[model samples]
Target chain A: MKKFLGAELFFESLYDLGIRTIFGLPGGYVLKIYDVMPSYSKKINHVLTRHEQAATHMADGFSRASGLPGIILCTSGPAATNTITGITTAYSDSVPVLVFTGQVPTPFLGSDAFQEADHIGITRSCTKHNTLVRKTVDLPKAIAEALFISNTGKKGPVLVDMPKDVLISESEYKMPKEVKIKSYSPKVPLKNSEYESFRKVLTASKRPLLIFGKGACSDFNKKLISKFLNKSKLPAMSSIMSLGLIDGTNKFNFGVVGEGGSAVSEDLINKADLIVSVGCDLIKIVPESNLKSKDIVVVNIDKANFNARTKGNMNIHTDSDNFIEKLSAEKGLSFEWEADNLQKLREKYLNSQEKEAKTNKRAGIFKLISNLSPKNSVFCSDFSYEDVILQKFLSVSDFKDSILSGGNGTPGYGFPAAIGATFARPKSKVISISSGINFQFNMQELIVTLEQKIDLTIVVLNEKKNKQKKYSGPDYKSLGESFGVKSHQLSYNDKNFENNFKKFFNHKGTALIEILI
Target chain B: MRHIISILVDNEPGVLARIAGLFTARGFNIESLCVAETEKPSLSRLTLVTSGDEWIIDQIVKRFENMINVIKVEDLSGEDSLERELIIARISTNQKTRSEVLRVADIFRANVVDVGPKSYALELTGNKEKLEAFIEILRPLGLKEISRTGLISLKREKKKITER
Candidate 1:
């Protein structure tokens, strides 16, 4: 067996796991991983993000878009701290992302060494699984487990914190064929009895409603979902995280249900006789009062948090995709409370909502986005204000195509995720929309786009009144111009603003369009 | 209600601190905590006692299992479990109390660890009720110094313990 630097073995392990890309910023104690990057550069494309936090968003974006584990690397201390929100966001949404952070040497670990951090301590609560490797031989095992645990039963973020000495030390490398944890059994396969129990409720649900949530977005079962929806002919709505589960054009598919949910979606949730929430945590979307209706069924991939989230009549512990697949096979009882009435209500309400959005300057961005978006476009957004527009107006064909911070609700998800989306689908158009303050969260990512020459368009909704005051009175145009991206600023009220907005939207290459409402 | 929850985690460095930090972050205090290596060489069992309402305890237990290092969490509150704490207490000795202290220790089955010039160090391990009873008896003897190992618990093997 040839001797190998632990870092070499670690990167090789990532390559073995089929991670073709890594997003990270280099810092102290993490220099070893960067030093070895050149050796694996051919096999892996490392996108160097400016802030360590954005590295996580980039990885999160990559994972959400590609359905593959996004690998993020950063040094210890502040670098690792930046991963908290991103990792938490991924954890909340159950996105598969593997994070690797450097640590000070073992001797200095507790002595408050320079650039030292208790990465495991900080991220344990936010990650699905995490470990700090003490030995070089364990590096390969740790990396394998990190990826395995991340992409396993309930997909989420995992971290492997490597001490500096462990990376520099020599080790004999042998890639493990399989990684297994005796304690971890992520899958609790559905029993026939359990599935049958849920099936009956779903079938007997007269005036039934279907709710799609984040769990549905992780791995969309397109055939299964559409078949289930069609057979039921139930008026379907999705949580904000699952905006693109069904296209807005689909009759059965109503708009999102959540914080920025439309008035119509709220009405549907309230009036439904039986709510069959598929893979959605009812707490995130349904108002607390409406969570417990006459009948509610919560079907989730992980049933661990369900009992706490709901006093539901039934909880099924099976993969959401599997449950939907099984549901499609069953000849579901016809729920005919009149699909026509709901469809008519949906059309009237959806149209009215759009008309209402068109009347206001701040909310008008939704109408503008809907009008300006061409075919084959995906939008990533951040925070409260912009989330409303992106969740409402952005036309999404697939849930995977729509990216936002659903669970973590962290800001600055837009830009980096757009960068990752560009990489995920190079042929399609990717847009990042956020309010000015939230947009500035990862404004440093401007360098990532410039260096990678990625095709992405960034649109900032500059709320006219800067309530936060931090993002006020700055020329966002100048900031983008400094980064060499085509920067343009226009007011929502400016004459011919619509024409310029469309032109900018249709323009090729990296660009930032700041809209001052 | 006060709940005793035990967590099984990977036996690695800083893991204890991580577990401690989680309590701090959530603004939950660990009333009594005892950690020891389990049967598995790479895993350790941590038993913590804390008091809270049903909802808070439920959330705390859920959060514990969600920790990356945590393998399992068992809230041993209402279960058929055995909880014990070790206490080493020093009693100021006198002609009258010296005999009384040993007589009390004898009844409690506690071992006399050391006999000082003016005090006796007695070691005891028992359930909360038993320990409290013994402490009450020793209170009149005067407590010089006391050290305690916080509660450590295990589910009394249900297969055998309940089968009989």
Candidate 2:
């Protein structure tokens, strides 16, 4: 076997794993990896982000958009700490992200050397798994294992802390043929008995409901799930994190089922006799008061997720994709759900929403944006009053079509995530919606969007005289101009609103539209 | 309601702290814990005692299995298993009570490890109930400083016996 430096193996492993792009900021300890960047520059494209946090958010967005483990690289100490919020965000949402942080030399690990931090200890609770590589030979195995742990089962962030000396040390390079952890198994085999039980309950119910949670929020599973729901004619609802699993036009599809969910959807959840929650924990799905009387079946890849809140009549230990495929393949499995009452309820709810939009300026602006969006456009929302408003009116055609910060609810996740979505789906229009105050959290990333020349449109809702006084300041148009991005300010109710909005929305490159309500 | 969870994990630095951190993060308390190297030197066995309902115990076991370094986890609660605890206690004694303490120790099969002018140090090993009984008997005899090696356990082997 030929000998290679740890840094060489690091980049080689990433290249072999099909990672074309990475986001990070170079610092003292991580200079070794950057030093070797020139040799393999063609294979890997590194985006030098303004801050480690933005880099992590970009990776998270990239992962959610591309369905691949997002990769983030940074140095030790403060740089590593900067990525905590982003890492926690990925952890909460169960997004698969590979985080590599450079550490001080192994000898200086415990001495509190400059730029040194105990990455493993600090990230233990937030990450699915983490390792501190002490030997150069262990680098390849660690990288492969971290990727595996992050992208499989209950997908979450995984961190690999690399000491400077180990990165520079030479070792015989042998690609690990197969990486397996004796204890970590992401897939639980589907047992025939459990499947039969699920089928029996699914087929026998008068009113059955299907709920899609983050566990079922995957690109590959979307078509299979939609086909299953349509064929069975089963009423379906989604959690906010998985808004787009069932197309908005699907007659059986109900909007969200959690906080800020529609009243009609909540009523449907209460009326349904049998609820097969795929990849959802069912928290808040069934009201605590009605939990005992509720009959639920939960299908999840990880048994740990099936806790007291998720305890059901039957728990199937299988992933969403596998469960959907198996359920769809079995012939003669049909649900006798009545769609007439559900249709009437949905129509009523939608009409009420339309009436509200006529009076509520925020709702009206969101409705206009939702109507004007092109087919297959991706919308990333930051945490604000507008985030919930957008979910209420926006129609999602596919999985990941509407990317909200599901788990961590991190502020300022919209813009960088949109940038990441643009890279992941270059052919599709990527739009970010945020309030004026929340957009300022990571507004500095506008320069990155301009530099990359990514095709993205950002809409910042500048609601004046807001109920929350502190969150009602800042001129986003001026800030966008400072970053050299095309900026426009317009009112949602302007006479030529449609024309002005389309001008920026259809722009070929990055644009920021500040909608004053 | 009490559970004894035995886990086998890779022996490495910070492994213990990680386990403790998991319990603390979930707002669960570890009542008593014992850890030491097993026959396989690279792996360590950790036995922790806790009390909760069945659901809480199930959650704890699942959470441990979710951890990467943990090799195996078995809840020995209500299982066919053997449990042992070791306790060393020093009891304040006088000439009138010294012999009485020794007599009680002899009954409990405990050894008088040290005999000082003011106190008698007794070493005992038994199941939880037996250890508790011994401590109760010694408390009135003026029990002083005490140290205990918390509960350690292993599953019992299933072996059949032939008639002699």
Which number leads on lDDT? 2
Instruction: For candidate 2, write residues A417-443 as lDDT tens digits.
Output: 888888788888888888887788888
User: How well is each residue in A1-517 modelled by candidate 1, as lDDT tens digits?
Assistant: 8999988987888888787888888888878888998988999999988887888998898888878888898999999998898899899889999999999998887788888877877786788878889999988888888888899877899989899999999989977777777667667677789888877776766677778887766444765677666776778888877777776777788777765675677777777777878778776555777766557777876645565645656877677777777776776367666867887888876787777677766567756775677666777888565565446666677777778887677878878888987877788788888878888888989988989998888988777564674447568999899989899998887999888888888877899999987
**Whole-model lDDT, candidate 2?**
0.83
- Model 1 chain B poorest ten-residue lDDT run: B155-164
Clash pairs (backbone) in predicted model 2: none
Provide C-alpha RMSD values for all models, in order: 3.0, 3.4
Per-model chain A TM: 0.94, 0.95
Q: Please give, for residues B21-69, the per-residue lDDT of candidate 1 as tens digits.
A: 7677778888999998887688888989988667767866776665556
TM-score result, candidate 2: 0.94
Clashes of 1: 0
